[model samples]
Target: MAAVIDERPHYRPARGIHPLHAVLLAATIPLFLGGLLSDYAYYSTFDIQWSNFAAWLIAGGMVFTGLAVLSSLIDLARARGRRKQALLTFVLLLVTFALGLVNSFVHARDAYGSMPDGLILSVIVTVAAILATWVGFSSLRVGVTP
Candidate 1:
């Protein structure tokens, strides 16, 4: 038997996963934390409704972000091929942000003048989502496999 070496350079980062995963972790943690803070703020502020669409979207996005980041970790267990995990994370991240994209257009007119909070929250979460996703993309495994 002959020892065969990988002909192609592995997608290993010279710096390691810290650059991507850490940054993503950093971006999303805030939305999750802010959800709690915002809830407190709303509760303290009078005449604020908690069960509205904006509340759900923001709170849900934060939770989703936290879950996805926790789930899609690239480590020694599946380090050889973590592309699938990467893909799943990408999809969830998209879904998390798509909510924002939808709200942006829907809140444009604001006929009732009911404070387009969903739109604002959506914008913030979407930006973080997009940035985190991009960082993940950079850390993704490229090239073909047999």
Candidate 2:
């Protein structure tokens, strides 16, 4: 009698950050920064008109980025089994989202100088978003096969 050998491929789960998440992070960071810079220029110069289009673009990017980060957080939680980190990321994401909303509504008055509060809020949100993104991305685990 001849011995039979089973040759079955082992199933490997998908790992690491999703490509979509990475792309979204890459895109959102620039858009968010650009919009803030444009805002600063408009405020500092007092001569240049800030484009509403840019503001809208920033808002959209923030929304998308928030969603992407949330997705990544869920993935990280599952892969790394770190619920605390995920929870903190979620809180930061919410803060960023709220700040973005406030930024969109508050407009700089042309006659008056730039609003210091708005600028400060924007800076805060930008930093928080970046931090959250870094944390979420770092927690992801890449699957390697040798």
Candidate 3:
């Protein structure tokens, strides 16, 4: 009897970050930065009325991105096994979301009027956004196997 040998490549489905998550991650940094700039202009320049429009628009975008991040985080948490990178990404996303909420509220309500405190919140949101983008994209390369 001759021994049989199998010669076939094992097939495995490719898994990675979801496209919606990628889109939201890509959008977060720019929106946060734009919000920061708009807030700066609104607070710094005394006669700039148009800055308020830009600020509000950016704030709305941030809130939308925050919701997307939360959705992605819930998906990550539901996955089986230990996903350290994904968990880290989720934490970063949470931070970004929280900061985004605060920033949006401040911008929408024009809280603190023209005071520089709003600018401070904008700066924090920008930093959190930057970190979230960095972690979220880096985790994409790691890939998740479902």
Candidate 3 TM-score, C-alpha based: 0.74
Candidates in order have lDDT scores of 0.50, 0.62, 0.67
Error of 1 at 146 (Å): 14
Candidate 1 per-residue lDDT over residues 122-143, each given as its tens digit: 5566665756566565554434
lDDT of 1 at 15: 32
lDDT for model 2 comes to 0.62
Candidate 3, 27-118: lDDT as tens digits: 77777777777777777665456357646656666765777668667767774543777787778778777777766666656534635756
Better of 2 and 3 by TM-score: 3
Clashes of each: 0, 0, 0
Model 1 / residue 1 / CA error / Å: 24
Query: Where does candidate 3 have its weakest 10-residue lDDT segment?
Result: 1-10
> By TM-score, how accurate is candidate 2?
0.70
Comparing candidate 1 with candidate 2, which one achieves the higher lDDT? 2
For residues 1-146, could you state the per-residue lDDT of candidate 2 as single tens digits? 12212222432443666778666655666666767776676567654455453466567767777776677566546644456666666666677777777776664333333355556656776787787677656656555311
Error of 2 at 50 (Å): 2.7
Q: In candidate 2, residue 135 scores what lDDT? A: 69
How far is 6's C-alpha from truth in model 2 (Å)? 28
